[model samples]
Target: MLTVIMASRNGAGWLKETLDAFAALHPPEGGWKLVVVDNGSTDRTSAVVRGFQQRLPLTALHQARPGKNAALNLALEEAEGDLVVFTDDDVLPDPDWLLQLRQAAADFPDTGVFGGRIDPCWPRPPARWITDLVPLGLVYSLTVEREDGPCDPQWIWGPNMMVRSALLEGGHRFDEEVGPDGTMAYRMGSETTFTKELAAQGARCRHVARARVRHMIRPFQMKRSWILGRAFRAGRGYWEPEPERVAILGVPRHILREVGEAAGRWAVARLRGNARERFRAAWDLNFWRGVLHEAWINRARPKRRADASRPGARDRTALSAGPD
Candidate 1:
């Protein structure tokens, strides 16, 4: 059996359609259940879920916390299946989504983690800039377009991922501090962190092409400001490079080198008058700026304990929203 879980906050508008998609899913060999966690939604999210109870194997739970991870933790308590799948409220799954996921699980029983493809469903025709940024993962999350096979777990997005229940049973949970906080404060790598930790514990991930979902893209996400802001948050989430990786004369020099490289890219783009190149350069500059911005923010704060001073430790303590 499988259990699908997702968290929502004031997402009633999208919840109804997603529930309709869930109701249309063809049952797997052992069936599946849906667990929707209401993360302090002020809208009609609960009523929407209740309306679906008679049509689907749906269970509604509430987490007063403000973070996506916190709500996911609440759903984990109610999830009851060997294979637990995670998705978002804004996604519409394929009719055979659960069937495909179950088939993959059966075929690759040894692989404990799985990710399916996520294609974009734009509300309107995307702007050229928006389309360009899609490959950068700033426009929409879960952009994996890999062939069916084993892959690095980090590419998996939270919106279309499944993992063995044993991981959660062993006390694994999403980092509360690193994901969406029920608002526009977009943080990156919430699922990536958990996947990296899973890989560290000797688990590999499989790519399931058939178990696909269509991620809804709002028109606002296509704007330059939104993309830039998303890039900034991504920079903060992915800023904690290994000391050995960025050890060229320490943090200061390494950041300088990156900034200089980005400036060169911008210069070349401007000289060539290539719109795509210019946008890419701008994205790189924003990401680097976000990295530096977060660094300054962290530097201003009080230092953490010796153990928490290690690489990636600060990200969890300062950026994460849940208990460490």
Candidate 2:
């Protein structure tokens, strides 16, 4: 049996499409269940799920906490299948997603966690170069064939991932301190960390190309301002070591280094071809801009320490102390 879980917050607009895609995958044998953890959505997210109850074996779990990992933990407690699959609310799985995942699991029974490919559904010409150059969209989506081996700790993403229930049973859970709620204060390394932990436990993790999902891109995400904002937040999340230590003490050097590195890359790409090089240059520039901007904001803003013993404290402390 397989259990599909999704964590959503005010995702009513997109939940219907996500649920519809999952509903289309109900196996004839009827050994699958869809579980949704609604994280205190003010929108009609619950109502939408209620509507889908008749069409699919949908169960909605509510968590008032505003964290993605918190919601995931709630779903994990309810999931009752040999295999547990996770997808984001803004994503729609490929029609044969479950079938492909089942085949992958069968081919490698030792595999504890598996992540599928995700691609942007909408294309923005203005940012196309940035997308192409950085491959920022989905660098972890590997094209390798089926082979049992240790999973790369850095290649996991939550949108299209599956983990054996045994892994969870063994006391594994996503880090609640980071992810979507952490915003600029903390960036997500949970997927990577979780996959690595599983691999360290002598379990195999693999990437399957067939288990695909299309990530929806909103108009806001395409705008330069929004992109830069996300980039800055991502950099802050990446650079800051602990949530409490994200103060003004270490911003200058970090900003200079990030910007300098980006500028150097852009200069190098300029010597290459126009089509690919320009795109690469744009992406590098944008990435650096985000990093530098984040450092500047970190320096300018007042610091507030919340839950000093949180999971990401080490990273935040490192950022506070000095360069990483």
Candidate 3:
């Protein structure tokens, strides 16, 4: 059997559409089930899930916790499938999404991770500014457009990725510090966190372009402030750069070069009145700022342990120092 899991918080707005899509899906060879984890939602999220229980093999779980990873980790207790699929409530998946994922799993049984394509579905007409950031894969969770076949597990997006049950069963869990938490400050990279750790343990990943989903781009995400904020957070998720412990002439060469490049880009973009270029420069600048802040934060604090899956040991406030 296969189990599809998702963590939602106040997602009733578009969840009905997603649930309806799941209802219409034709089960694969071994049959499939749905597990919905309500992550501290005040809306009618539970009601929506309960309503769909009659139509789909649904299981509703309530994780009073605030984070997406927390809800997903809670759902692991109820998961009963050899292949576990993960998605989000706002996503509108194709009818054959499960079929394609199952087929890919069958074809690549040894591969530990499977990532599907995520195409954007704008709620309203997107402005030029919003569309411009799509190619960067920074505004949202869209992965490599031209990428397919075997690729790095880091390329996997959370909205449509699957992993072997054995990985989760082996006590590997998503990093609680990262991922959505129904907050404006939510840091991305929950899926990537677990996938990378699994990859280090000799696991491989595959990209299944055939399994596709339409990622909903809400109106809020189009705002300049929101987009820029996401870009900044994404920088923090990209990697936590270490502080320059050694400096020549009391200055770090890399920091100086990065600052100079950022200033140059910002100046050129402003002079040319290029919105895209302006935001691109801002994104890089913010990323470096995040790295600097993280380095300072880490430097001021003592080193912590590395085990992320231990019960009651996960740091609720610690953020994932993204990919290096």
Candidate 4:
């Protein structure tokens, strides 16, 4: 059986729609079960899950701890399937989503990570400022447009992806330091953290293009400030300090210089009265600023440990220097 997991927090309205889509799903060959973890919701989120109990093979869990990773960790205790699929509470999946993911796993028996296609259902057509400045994949968790086959596991984001149960059961857990925590600002890319570690252990990854879902893009995300804030958070998530790079107080010296330069660019863009250039410059400024701050915060943890999965995998920068 494939056990699908979701974490919800005060998103009852959206969850209702997502569950309705779930109700229409075509069950996979091994059958499927749904587990919705209530991540400290004040709304009727629990009631919503209960409403779907009779419609799907559903299990409801409550994790009062705020973060999304924490809630997912709680649900891991109930995982009992070949694949532990992860998704958000604000998505409408295709009818054959489970069947498609199951087929991908069956077709690629060795691949431990599977990514599904995520299309955005925007609230409305976005303005040019957004279209020109914001990236769908960065903020919205949309995957490669329509490509299939082998791809980088990092591209497989949290909105829709599946992993083999053995890894989690083997004691792998999500890093609570990262991922959503019901805050105005937080790091993204929880699943990518786990998947990369599993990949380091020599587990192959794949893109299951047929398994698709439409991630609902709320109106709040359209605001420039929110997008800029996300850019900073994205950089924070992307941070991986090169051990050999010169540093002081854990932050690379080069980063300080780059941030200063970005500030100069930001000033110049503002002077030029170019909306696009100003936004681009501001985006880079925010990204580098985030990287600089994270670098300083991770100062003591200078380098990553060698990949323990293989005898001699190449050393590379890691997302969270903290343990999984």
Candidate 1's error at 103, in angstroms? 1.0
- Please state the error at residue 90 of candidate 2 in Å: 1.7
User: On residues 132-193, what C-alpha lDDT tens digit does candidate 2 reach at each position?
Assistant: 44334322222234333444544546777889888888678976755656233345355555
Which tens-of-lDDT digit does each residue in 162-248 have in candidate 4?
A: 999876767998878777888755765567677777887777888888899999988988888988787677667666756778876
- Where's the lowest-lDDT run of ten residues in candidate 4? 315-324
Question: In terms of lDDT, which candidate is strongest?
Answer: 4
lDDT of 1 at 11: 81
Clash pairs of candidate 2? 187-237, 241-315, 241-316, 242-315, 242-316, 242-317
TM-scores for the candidates: 0.84, 0.73, 0.85, 0.91
How much does candidate 4 score in TM-score? Answer: 0.91
For model 4, name the residue pairs that clash. Answer: 250-299
Regions more than 4 Å wrong, model 2:
28-30, 123-127, 138-151, 182-186, 240-256, 259-324
TM-score, candidate 2, is 0.73
- Arrange candidates by TM-score, highest first: which order? 4, 3, 1, 2
Hey, what RMSD does candidate 1 come out at?
4.9
Q: Backbone collision count in every prediction? A: 4, 6, 0, 1
By lDDT, the candidates rank as 4, 1, 3, 2
